[model samples]
Target: MSIWWSLHLRRDAASVPLARRFLLGAMETAGVDPEISFDLSVALSEACANAVEHGGDRRVQREQSVGRDPWDVWDEPAGTACGQYRVTAYLDGEKCRIEVADSGPGFPARRMLRTSAQQHDPQLYPSLSAEDGRGLCLIEQLADHVHFGNRPGRGALVSFDKVLKWRKGALLMVS
Candidate 1:
């Protein structure tokens, strides 16, 4: 059986857990192993958190370009009005894939290239000394495969997949 779902979410903190819960529900319904479900949920949360924190609004970007603080723009009540992101998940056969895309300014070309090259090099990323920068690396560690890229002027996209381990009575077991 094949299962897929997608969500369009406001760039708010609450959306992170909401997204994770959806994935967990889907995985549980499919009888996926709990350990695998947990790992994917953690990865999904990181991606959603990054989307909430960094997903930009064009208006907010413009404000920052002209010397206004980005945080100040977000501090306004309208911060989430134009900021949105998407999360999609697919489960087919033996693997499950999840994708998170945002309408914020995409990754810098240089950093994107560097990160793609060093995806497996944990040492290349800084220790979790700060709160904000560890999401991408954490996602990489959890998923069997990951891809990071941009949608031109649209935003950044982070996609990842893992080989699924079925529970004893999995409804979608391949074997």
Candidate 2:
């Protein structure tokens, strides 16, 4: 049986590379198929990228000290993503859950979904194209569960989960 791995990572754009490495490691250790690994990588990359981009404008400082891998810049303390934008990764069997949190203003999930449809619907006018807003759509397609909510006065948390393979298109079981 594949083992479940729980890891906490500091929230920073530089930490994204580390997240990918960790996921890839878990995938390899679990003997996950190449195709599935590819999917996991892509999904994880997008999630981590979102964390980094949303972490902060000038506040997203990446440390390059002590032989920086150039991939993971090491954000130091958690929650202090400039003030504590933590990222947590959970891997169990063929299931994976990733959460990215930041101490900033939250977004409206409904509006985000609606805008995504309007942008990627293809039927929409070309003049209404949105360069952004596609991340959540892509994420929803990749993950079985996509949740967004406010962290009170902190900021927001985006949670996503995926099952590697099994019955295709299977819904994410809550229990």
Candidate 3:
């Protein structure tokens, strides 16, 4: 069976763990290996954190473009705010896919170039002392496949997927 869920989370720090917890619960229920789940959760947190920190800029830009007060979005309902991000997960027969999308300026062209190079050799682009610039690398290392890009006029998108390794007697085991 294929199971999937999507969340529209506020651009707040708390949403990071909330997304992770939901992912963990889904993985546990599907009988995914704990180690794999942990890896994915960490990667998810990094992506969510980036969104929480940067996603607001795009909302402000969009609001300005449409002649609305940038702060007006804040008055909307919790999840309905323009300053929000999306997290989606899919657990299929043999793999799980996770995506985090946000309303931000998106990655710069140079960053994508660096990301491609890092994917080939992450060691070549280590940020030992820096606070940021490690999230995409971490996600690349944890996931079997990762795609980073933008959604046209929307914003940044980070999509990653891993081949599911089942625990003993997994509910959705493909055996």
Worst 10 residues of 2 by lDDT: 166-175
lDDT of 2 by residue, 7-123 (tens): 455555667788778877766665555566667677777766665666542343345234544333223322234433456666565677777766555565443333444545655
Clash pairs, model 2 backbone: 79-83, 79-84, 80-83, 80-84, 81-84, 81-85
Clash tally, candidates in order? 1, 6, 0
How accurate locally, in lDDT, is each candidate?
0.80, 0.58, 0.80
**Which residue pairs in model 3 clash with each other?**
none
Index of the highest-TM-score prediction: 3
lDDT of 1 by residue, 6-72 (tens): 8888889999999999999999999999999999999999999888887765453444336555333
lDDT of 3 by residue, 1-175 (tens): 8899999888889999999999999999989999999999999998899889876573343334355454444333222244788899999999999998876777777565335545677465656888777877888889888888976556778999999899999988787
Worst-scoring 10-residue span by lDDT in model 3: 72-81
